[model samples]
Target: MNTQIKGRTISLRLVRKEDAKFIYSLRNNKEYNQHLSQASGTVKDQELWINEYKNRENKGAEYYFIIERLDNEKRIGTLRLYDFIGNKESFCWGSWILNQDKTRSSAIESAMLVYEFAFKELHFASCHFDVRKKNINVIKFHKKFGAEITNETNLDLFFQLTKTSYGDFFTRNNKFIEN
Candidate 1:
């Protein structure tokens, strides 16, 4: 599988131990951390965590990505793909956090890239994830991408997007992913 997935304006590369500082900053950024699980500890802790994560990555159990702008090659965001289910028929992805100061396109492009990697590269039939109930904007974003809400709880809403649904979304949003 490819280590880096490039899009029209941005690319996603596997997270390395060296990215601990950046990841730590993003995890603690008030603007982006509201909807995410609380992250604590120093950059050293993050580095240690990444060291362990690398082993899972090697075993094909999970993937964490650092999103960067292709023009300047600056790291701008982070996302992860994990929680494989149904014998590779579906996968769960979360930990999506992006810099607020950057262009909004980063959000769209990063998501497009994730779906591309999951479906095209990993051959997963569908993507399933949960969004915090209070994260309305993200809920809308997934709905617009044709993800169906399958369940909801006190804290989160679960959604699913099949490959067919993504194919349809791709047809409509081709500009974001096309050359």
Candidate 2:
């Protein structure tokens, strides 16, 4: 997989077909499914999904990335930007990050870096994320990144960050920090 974004201690890259096994293992972990878009099923089912995802050609519906720790080059998680809708001037985005216990924070940081790439490099007008209402920790983390709650239903809470807003956030949060 070619590296797409590299942070101080993490790397994000395109998911390859060879990664199906790794994805299979991680997706089966119950903890990883808590906030996932879909539930895990049999191994055959997971494999089928991975194959379809690997073969999918529609740029309009999905984009996937694998998150790895730089120190050991370990595949710890995956992130996806989905439901693309709009013109060149504007688009909507959503993502997911999943990892085992020890690498959870790194996964989150990698996700933030990917989001930076999405808004800054890709020139997306806005990015959004939806979380299950029960995932309080993730909700808090999104708040720390300056995401605001825009809508809530019985099942989910939606958060959004416009390019203008995220630019200010990136500046303020890194003003004194050195890589």
Candidate 3:
């Protein structure tokens, strides 16, 4: 697979071993990490995890990406697509975090690129993911992008966005991602 998906202002590229520190910083940054799963261990541990993640990435099991600015190549966020279900029928994406000082469009462009890669390149039928109830902003963000809440637990809400719905979203917001 081509490891990089480019958008107008931001791009998603495969995470590398060298990205351990960046990833660690984002996960440990209190401003951004509150809604995310707690990441424990040192940067060395993160590197070890990336080593294993590389193996899975090579096997087409999962993908982790670094979202970076086009003009300066500065990484601003991270997200992953994994937990595929039912023979590529659906995939779950999480570990999404952005810098507190990130560019205004990084979040939107990163999401557009992810869905573009998933629906167009990978041919997935839908996306499935869960958001912590505390992450209200992210929940609203996904809803605005056409994801529907299918289920919920006490702590999290599960969402599903079919490719068809994503097509509508893409059409409505295409200009934001135009090259």
Candidate 4:
């Protein structure tokens, strides 16, 4: 799709084959993988997955984005939007991980970029995520965006943000984002 979302602290670009190794390492990293779905095997495995993903007929079905530092353009992590619900009117957001050096503000900035892409660019009615039950950090993070816990399985907790709720959130929190 050759798309990029530029944010104040980071930007998101479509995943490319060149990012296979970086993604593989990030997916397997212990520090970040506890609640994350593990990506085992090798970088070649990731390459194969990427190849298959790129071949999907509907690119909107899955948007895999590499998150990079705006300052030096260093690829730090990734965020993916998928599992479209309500006839692609809404989607599930996941596959997010940021470098340890990136602070909470950086995470928020990256999320702001993702929400902007989902709600503004894609015009999706809602965006949500399934967070692993044990990932308290991320669960709390999602709550800050006013994402309500909607459903739960033994392993995961799902949260969603409606377009209206999201807009209202930004209106209330513009001060925090300004500086």
Using TM-score as the measure, name the better of candidate 1 and candidate 3. Answer: 3
Please give, for residues 44-80, the per-residue lDDT of candidate 1 as tens digits.
9999999999999999999999999888888999999
Mind giving the per-residue lDDT tens digits that candidate 4 earns over 12-55? 89999999999988888888888877677999989999999987
TM-score-sorted candidate list, best first: 3, 1, 4, 2
Query: What is each predicted model's overall lDDT from 0 to 1?
Result: 0.91, 0.68, 0.91, 0.81
| lDDT of model 1, residue 60 | 95
List pairs with backbone clashes in candidate 4. none
Question: lDDT of candidate 4 vs native?
Answer: 0.81
Ranking of models by lDDT? 1, 3, 4, 2
TM-score of each: 0.97, 0.81, 0.97, 0.91
Error of 3 at 23 (Å): 0.6
Residue pairs with colliding backbones in model 2 are none
User: Which runs of model 2 end up more than 4 angstroms from their true locations?
Assistant: 1-3, 40-48, 54-61, 88-95, 101-108, 175-179
Cα lDDT for residue 45, candidate 1? 100
> lDDT by residue for model 3 over 1-179, one digit each (tens)?
89779888888999999999999998998988887778899999999999999999998889999988888889888999999888779999999988865678888888888899989998999999999999999999999999999999999999999999999999899988897
Model 2 quality (TM-score): 0.81
> Model 1, residue 82: displacement in angstroms?
0.3
Cα error of candidate 2 at position 135, Å = 0.2
